[model samples]
Target chain A: MSQKAHDIFFRSNAPVTVDEDKCIAHKGCTVCVEVCPMDLLAINPLTQKAYMQFDECWYCMPCETDCPTGAVKVEIPYLLR
Target chain B: MSLDNFLNLEQEYDIVVIGGGTAGPMAAIKAKERNPNLRILLLDKANVKRSGAISMGMDGLNNAVIPGHATPEQYTREITIANDGIVNQATVYAYAKHSFTTIEQLDRWGVKFEKDGTGDYAVKKVHHMGSYVLPMPEGHDIKKVLYRQLKRAKIAITNRIVSTRLLTDASGAVCGVLGFDCRSADFHIIKAKAVILCCGAAGRLGLPASGYLMGTYENPTNAGDGYAMAYHAGAELANLECFQINPLIKDYNGPACAYVTGPLGGYTANNKGNRFIECDYWSGQMMWEFYQELQGGNGPVFLKLDHLAEETIQTIEHILHSNERPSRGQFHANRNTDYRHKMVEMHISEIGFCSGHSASGVWVNERAETSVPGLYSAGDMAAVPHNYMLGAFTYGWFAGHSAADYVAGKEFSALDKEQIAREKQRVYAPLLREHGLPPAQVEYKLRRFVNDYLQPPKVTRKMELALERFDQIEEDIAQLKAANPHELMRAMEVAVIRDCAEMAARASLFRQESRWGLYHHRVDFPERDDANWFYHCHLKKDQSGRMVSHKREVEPYLIPLDDHERNAYDKLRLKAANG
Candidate 1:
């Protein structure tokens, strides 16, 4: 076998979740994405729906509270919980 | 590719305010009010509407010196005593004198404060001596109110820009700021006559004991950006050893809010559900008692509220859930704990630098002016000692007015292109790397070292070892890779965190005496040596670009305290019943 550089991925559950049915990101609404202080949420390019892009959520609830359609849910991060 | 090929944007302003959460907004508003003709720009790494420590809004003023309740001199005396007589009384007195005016201004701006039917402010007593804590049962909309005022003042707002370094001129005066948009990675160079740093605390310096990085008592966005920027800009940072450690909810890692619960008859109790401390005011002496109780086999404290009436608990629940970390309700519900039946578990928070809670920040005078000529600082990042949100607003008001007066006839110094060029390369390196270490892993390892080595009960050998590890992390910073602009922002924050960690270690090593309870408790130098260490221990970058620590005398008090008042905080621990 030849030695070469490669990448590995770690899997974890996202604390901030968005409901696909209620998400209005396709309509150009990025309320959840914009309101996040940590900038952890982003709109999925394929689905045009908002999703948690990172695991670093403060669980501050601004995303859920400021969501236009009540599409966002912030759970306590598993490690803290 | 050359730096010019990237999106390099430049703008000019009379004054630039960074970190738009609480103080930055007030700074911009007051600067505009001072001189409406002056162009002001306010920027934040996060959206200005929701940034900084009070992004979700605060529950109440922890140190409101209102008339008929407390005098300015009295409040100053109380703070001076609480901080073990090391505070600059003039700065605290300045905040106390202007505290009511700021409160009235907030009231006029449609923010509600709890007032009795007799038309008097309902002030509650939570401190050891004076009455402060004024509640805002409806303060969740404070950011909305501030955003409205910013728009009304016509202050130019730039959101999602993470400021990396302040640009200084040949005369060593701050002339501009260098930062990049977190979403686009576009470079920004804003020329300004004066710059006000209200960038909150170095809250993310220590990792939470639960091993969660973002689970911090202060907002995770405040990753010591202002402190790092000020230090690199040649500003004196006072009392780096005096760290901010609070009694917070375990695992969840947020304030149990003794100010709120204590007023409502909820108290901090040991495992046996008995009170051990007389006061819940978050002073060093109070935290000392809390640490003693936690360590003396009376471990794992709780906020006892089961004895309170159902209606009072309801009020507590409504207030705690509706404002400032509103998710507290969700965390509690998930754990199946209620204030009516179960006592909410409490634990001491990890250490960080915050003048608002204990006093470790950029040194500024009563006028909010830093040692640097064109730079001003306020809020948690500035060393005003026990300057909570209200002090943030009041000192912000002072910084705004002072910077306005400063820039009256001054011209923007030419932007230092060399500084801009160097910062641009430093910032973009992570994104441009082919393959390397992830920023999160690096941050995790770094913060774990912080907890291991620097979480008080400070040992000299451990801190020295921590410095060696910090130096190793500095090399690790160069290997960080960012897949996107957001990741790049965090990568840069890793660099800032490294700088703060090194500074914390050096400052802790420089101070030989244990003081401020567990904040600077060095086991090797266990006693408080007033004769030898009575002066403020300040740290700054020396001429050789080395971090150097020095001593500065504590300014004489404007309001002298009697011997009894001076030793008041020393008696916070309740004597045993048998004694």
Candidate 2:
């Protein structure tokens, strides 16, 4: 009766990262989040800064190119790298 | 978190273009040019600034059909032969005849093509029998050019909306589109007199061999949305059995791009650095040779650029790394494999349905009209053989003009309330579930099953098992839970992927022949059967809403090939010197 099936978390690095100091997310700019093809980047409510919320990075770098403040950097995922 | 559904939001457009990629933008622009008074809506799941197959931009046009380099007749003959005689020649001819016009249009629009000293289109010979590859050394700005045109035309743009299904009327013609925003989960209902679906290939149908889910040749956002949407709207899909399997850079899972580097002195080589095939143009027959070499004693295949001169290698690197998939350079650098010292490892990509590289997509006539009324298609999702990016633009032009004419005196068909409600429930079920399977897990499993079974050298039993497994996965689809709208978008994509998987299997089963080389190599029927199976295999949703497969006869050729030209692709394998 006590047998439980629960979820566990695995750690991996996010391929797309945003520099908080330059993000301008709190100042109301969402260009990096808006231009991402995969919709993987979002602004964290607590931090008021953009960040990658999913591991599904295609490494097709619109977030880096389209960013207004040059805040986003895309690295090839470890597996592919 | 409770779902923030945008139920009350509705829209109406005179003509709606469902993807803002290579084709959809052109469709909207040309439709406006046809009638500037018509209200057109250009929509996408991502920002139009960065979307579709050419999101990062294309390196070159795979099929250019320029004036002095190749005529429409020659290009048509080449495509007809490459596809093994199962082509809608009228459609290919239409694309061929107008190919130069489309190139001119792009050229005038500030998009550039490679030019000779005399200002002629510098078309290179990459195909087995024709010169079609037109390099775009500065082609990375294609999306920017399209975006400029879209804005100058004053077209309305909506981003982040994933269009899921088509809304049909009482007579079963597409009248509206139903979808949700991936970021906000807001519902969209767009009413129109005509609709065009340019939503690229079903690229995410099979799992890449690397076990990394996101690494696919086509952008992962494609995910078969247009193919599934067309089928549900009663549009016929042609040659789904002839799958798209490219020879990609091994673990990176992107194109090695022989089209660009082949003319520059690079070629596909085996482990011993010997050119096994005479031509590097991507064809099912060529892929078949590639698979043979990979399975042969030269087990690992590679892109051989090590012998190229230093200047040519630098030029190749600049073009390859800057356009299409820019991260390719990073991947090569991470592995520390320089093209000067070593060959780049290559492998066959997982299969999908793409009419751009191979002929498998929603059936569209020469006018770009689908079987269903008021519906049109172009791009990788539309069946026009090796249409590539230029074909997307050309067919997009056709769909736009055709839809503009079709909707001139047309009236909007009434939307069905019941259909909307049913789709709303289906779309939001995963978001409402308390706790269950995750969309990513389900998608990973489904695609892995696709790789295990439906990937070529087709075994009859394995495909049947794939259908059964796909049916089981539908149960898992129902149980899928999403914590947020972003996840919900992926959840809906999983549903579309499942539909495409089922279609791929059923269509492969109906073909019953080993044609297109490694693409549809049915083990039981191991040879090309022209007598019984020369027709194109089409799949669609029958009147009863059941999946059905039937053979559609290939249209009579507008340009017939000579005996020697017909078998050019078949003799691609280079014979040994002694033999």
Candidate 3:
């Protein structure tokens, strides 16, 4: 195939953040990940801590509200903020 | 990425309910209750535990026709006037009569409602005429309550499957569904005797003013998937031009929620801190006045609660912060806005299709049956004007029982191999291609065009241009690439959004006259032409697979509304000077 198409990346900040010290993802807690309607959060494999994988947060705040521990924080997406 | 390499899973069900949101869960549970032997499957793109519009749960029922507070006839009349008389009165009346029963059912299921000292249901007056706003102070766990009911009713649920299309048999009746898992990229070919669509509003059709794609008033996950699927299945969609435009908190895009706070003494006011409209009901007329206030140099409307007592402010905060978009409290705090000190700034939201707020959705009858047999619709997606959460539950009960009766002794039709194969190829094409356009970028561009041309104060020429742009976006959709299953779900949604954009433009162009306040406001046709455009404008896919638009006669009124009652919503603006 010709080099007619190539993927380009753009930098964007994830509005949702998880506190490493408070996150219990390592202890098999995926409450935040499971409850996110957008499926934006995930457990980082290397650290086994919950983190936002995708920048597409609705700011509806299910992850933060349903987090087993108070580790998750959802900010207004930067464009809106 | 050949078809042979992919895993295909086939499931058999008596009925499949798409969208495990407010209505889908109710439909599934009620169907199982109606006929325990029937196997029902309830699915959602997100987890059933937290899905759809009420993901974080709602603050109050906007239209709860509880007895003693309001009669079914009165509520029906109110909605008829609010929708500018383009409603199927039988559907509205049916929802009205069953409203109390639905509320009682929720009460029995552990959902709490505010009550007075006399133990009466404390329904508040918020509509232009009736007292319908019933507050749910502890409504944050409404989904949890519904989930418990689902388990008790023995209803099966599959979460994280994004339904793409409805499969129809040779006779053109819906028989099954086609979708893929958003995480595993596995195909779900569900064969069903009946399919109930409860997919909430076409929320992601227009770009929010903030330019954030996901910061939509409706759950961004909705993306008009139900509207697109119903159109493809040849179901008629009513009043697509009557868009859902709400007065939301500026930048935050969620409802400033006058319905919740209005009964507690908060009112929508202009920047001068004076009330402009007489009523806080979210009718199109009320929004027209709101739009006038914003554009007429008295810009930036606010939810005025600053004059309330300190205790009242705290009480407002407790209920508003804890339920229905709880990030609201944080949003206020981030801006240093407090109900006691500063009024929350409000702005007009971008347009979308939602019968829950405005009249634009899949056309269904009193029994929740669409034009296509065996296909039922309910909730925000179904065309029941002003049918909020309570109506969702009521219509859902109707759909469930109707579908339960529909599936009795009805054998599943033979699956179309060609349809399934074609859908499989279309679904996996993005993943098969090495490189192409991204779904998010495509969606953003499409929605931007929707706002540009389709957002009302609509012009004939701009809408024509929008059709042209939407065609180009259709071409762009063919080149979309998805790296994984999650992006693939979004890629499919872009196509859905494009379909809705075209539908919105076509429906607006077909109407030719302005009616529903700012919703169908045509710059060219500024007058409400009830003489010619009194009927409902419906859109659907014709026999040739071409999108077509036409008019349907409005059903004769079940309960007659006097001339004064018919014009009630038109007088929402206060005749007195601003105070």
Candidate 4:
């Protein structure tokens, strides 16, 4: 399969983004990945950060606020806001 | 197919409430009643009938009042004692004083109650409110009431929705919320002066059983969308720690104490059927005070429930049988899917299930402000305010009022685009990756570990191992990828599981002693540990993104019930009877 040009829109299956410096890697991101239920999460080896595979992602966070580390963050679509 | 039109829709309202539970409708209706012609909209992921975990027209009631029988003071003490007094005094009163009114309002709206021919409503015995305990309404019943009210009051009801982001203008205040109607899969731009998140908790995310619905009453629609949405909106949260536990069931299998409480009727047993609670765990006081015989000891200890009095057996049988209701498990859209249905059937169906699942959630003040601005939390979603399980009615009202109050303000500002962009990246980065195990794997491993190590009570060095297990599970979860909505939701359950772990760990570490109901085991701390542990565990969402756990002193109050509040209430009770 070819790599899809990751379009990280809120409504899309894409998970949010990550700023390396800002992430505490507090285990919260893991929750967001699992909460989505669908295999929406794809961890990047190079960045050690989370990114959404839009096509695969379902937009709920099960590992939601459970993480003590608070690494995972949610981004609502700008339009809805 | 185009969500743009919906996304660009700018809507203004006198009040914008997030949840449609018992309290949300009340707040919206009351606000409108407080002022007619107020444009108010109640946004919920599902129908208003099933907004919260618990609804009206059921046996559960906050008003535990019995005429010429029970008193609120005793009720207060029993509850406070069960919660170890971590409950908010004002909050306790808020529920205690207004319970009658809550039921009355529901009744006025056509909520049915199982009452006696004498025109008196019955009580759950355990859930007695002040002077009158209201009847439990079915989730469906509540939806009907809200549907009628919303239509009549001209309140807009948005359904099949999930709020994804909290929109703040240039200033730090809330502008509105970004959400989507899952049924249409169309994103919506909910621009409002303020946003209130009444979506319930991650309890739906915990193990096979979630919250009140654990025993076949699970609400899959209660996906942690609200908590996640609120966290991203920049509102701080508290006590993301402290999930209610009693995820315990009467299933006849497992290893060690963590697996099963063994037998019922005060008997304790292990795998070999030898008496455990009676032989080992039972205290001297228990042996002397209680008169149950502990014959035939091995590993599993079981109180001989057979040949017991019919009435006594019937009571226990009723509780066990009541677990048959399929309302909770069948309600959530996610549970119907193959992956999740297997889970619900496997664990929840195993004979013994406890209503004691969990009662902890986000921490909030009387005003319902979380750690962040332009946001609030409520319901079972709210953290450990008092050690008691606050139902949908209380938190629903609190969050609704708090958020509505916050939004009514005129001050407005815009958010810095740079920070917003950064937040945007944080929110969806995980969805774009290709590598790692699926979120479902992480969810499974989490359930497996927490069930083994951190279930409750016996706090020990074992927690470190559990935490380590969590670490591995975390890595595994980070790898999960979704195939569709079904798979995605199962994965989401993992997120809730992780939160429960964190909350449990937070309380476990801080509370070096055992206390409270259902979960607080004596071997864990051996004492209430009130002096150091009476405070509430406050959790919040930091920019890095999970729970930021902390502690706050539970406000101590006298109410000065002083014989007078008691006398006054007693007289009122009499007057109510006569009238």
Alpha-carbon RMSD of each model: 1.3, 1.5, 1.2, 14.3
Q: Which stretches of candidate 2 lie over 4 Å from their true place?
A: A1-6, B1-6, B577-579
**Model 4, B32: alpha-carbon shift in Å?**
3.3
Which DockQ value does candidate 2 get? 0.77
DockQ list for all candidates: 0.80, 0.77, 0.79, 0.02
Off by over 4 Å in 3: A1-5, B577-579
Error of 4 at B462 (Å): 3.9
lDDT of 4 at B369: 63
Clashing pairs in 1: none
In candidate 2, list every pair of residues with a backbone clash.
none
Among residues 3 or more apart in sequence or in different chains, the pairs in candidate 3 whose N, CA or C atoms overlap within 3 Å are none
Write the residue-wise lDDT of candidate 2 on B1-579 in tens digits. Answer: 433545547999999999999999999999999999999999999889999888888889889888878899988888999999998899999999999999999999999888999988888988887888899988999999999999999999999998999999999888999999887788898999999999999999999888888889899999999999999999999999999999999989988879989999999998888888999988999999999999878759999999999999999999999899988888899899898998999999999999998999999999999999999999999999989999999999999999999999889999999999888888889888878788889999999999999998999999999999999999999999888888899999999999999999999999888999898999978989999998988899987889999887877778878987788898888897113
lDDT of each: 0.92, 0.91, 0.91, 0.46
Model 4, C-alpha of B325: deviation from truth (Å) = 2.6
State every prediction's TM-score relative to the real structure: 0.98, 0.98, 0.99, 0.63
- Please, what are the lDDT tens digits per residue for candidate 3 over residues B1-579? 676766898999999999998999999999999999999999899999999999988888888888889999998988988899999999999999999999999999999998999989889998888899888888899999999999998898998999998999999999999999998899999999999999999999999999988989999888899999999999999998999999999999888889888988899988888888999888888889999999887878999999999988888889888888888888999899988889999998999999988999999999999999999999999999989898899999999999999999998999999999999999999988888999999999999999998888999999999999999999999999999889999999999999999999999999988898999899999999999999999999999999999988999999888986888888877776343
Highest DockQ: give the candidate number.
Answer: 1
Better of 1 and 3 by DockQ: 1
lDDT of 3: 0.91
> Which tens-of-lDDT digit does each residue in B1-579 have in candidate 1?
445556999999999999898889999999999998999999999998888888888899999999999999999999999998889899999999999999999999988899999999999999999999899989899999999999999999999999999999999999999999998889998999999999999988999888888999989999999999999999999998999999999998898878898988999999989888899889887888888888888878999999999999999998899899999999999999988999999888988999988899999999999999999999999999999999999999999999999999898799877898899999999988878889999999999999999998999999999999999999999998888899999999999999999999999999999998889999999999999999999999988899999999999889989987789998888887114
Interface RMSD of each: 0.9, 1.0, 1.0, 15.3
CA displacement after TM-score superposition, residue B513 of candidate 1 (Å)? 0.9
